[model samples]
Target: MQGVTVVDHPLVQHKLTIMRSKDTSTASFRRLLREISLLLCYEVTRNLELTSKVIQTPMQEMEAPTLEGKKLVFASVLRAGNGLLDGMLDLVPAARVAHVGLYRDHDTLEAVEYFFKAPSDLENRLVIVVDPMLATANSAVAAVEKLKSRGATNLRFVCLLAAPEGVERFTKAHPDVPVFTASIDERLNEQGYIVPGLGDAGDRMYGTK
Candidate 1:
């Protein structure tokens, strides 16, 4: 609640509604995800500091504003997170990218990491961790933990949808990381899925089971 932001722009809401429909095709769902991710990126990076730079225009040289500090690092939490990553890259082409591959143990519902690779200078950059659904907060929390351990300090979490339980758990686990999402659903189902969610984001987006 305190550190969460819902991107309620009309375009974001409209695309989310389209994504939620069970009838939407896999291709359509992926397209909408990319589109909405751009909007989400806008909100997540809203407060990035800017510095003035003197540059030459077609007609004259003048001072212009540009992002301050090192290029941001966008850390994607495996397959599903890549859906959001593709779109975020569209908005911030210069930003660095990281991948954290984690999967939930079926029985235990705990996150397990298989792969992790990020920029060496994470200490000097802002890191934005992304996953489509923050259902249990297991993967999201684990991913952020890994990033922090690797020297990432300034961090944010962005997702397409979040459950109240996941948000509470995530915020409690990482109080310093702000969260950005399109919607916060009511609750998680017994299977750790968000009700009224867009189904399994990975499945719908990639035609997986």
Candidate 2:
């Protein structure tokens, strides 16, 4: 659909497998996050506007296409999203980064915001709200809502993996924004975890819980 993209890249699948394994070491998990983020970046920027520019090459002058419009803002959804940010930055080094922290309450399953910071001119730039695991969609939806409230008009959501339930909820909540993920698994478990999905991305990345 227009609002969702399930990336079929082989490398994405390879790294995702590593990330999903329960035995994957913390350092490896961190590395996989970075690699997957870079892969996601390629798909995310595929439709970016491009304009021709004249530039002098080593041999001669040539007209080359360059990205157009305001630079993108990589807005990481706190802890887990931070792991995705560094790799995306490698693809777009000059891009600015914003941080939004939201934690799902274990009891209520509600998204709680502890920190939020973004570019003041977000309305003119494309914003990518990133997190590795989009499970129930509460944190992700809340993050996007908060960004819209802060004058963000152009927006895209990126995550390494997603649950089908999360995808349905997120798309229904904000159909106008596109979401890019490496994989979408089965339904969420009773504890709101993605069934057979990577266990607690936040914990895997940080070695906590």
Instruction: Judging by TM-score against the true structure, name the best candidate.
Output: 1
- RMSD (CA, angstroms), candidate 1: 0.7
What TM-score quantifies how close candidate 1 is to the native fold? 0.98
C-alpha lDDT values of all predictions: 0.95, 0.92
Question: Worst 10-residue stretch by lDDT in candidate 2?
Answer: 1-10
Question: After best superposition, candidate 2 residue 182: deviation in angstroms?
Answer: 0.8
RMSD of 2: 1.1
Q: Per-residue CA lDDT of candidate 2, range 17-36, in tens?
A: 98889999999999989988
How does each model score on TM-score? 0.98, 0.97
Could you tell me the lDDT of residue 115 within candidate 1? Answer: 99
Model 1: CA > 4 A from native: none
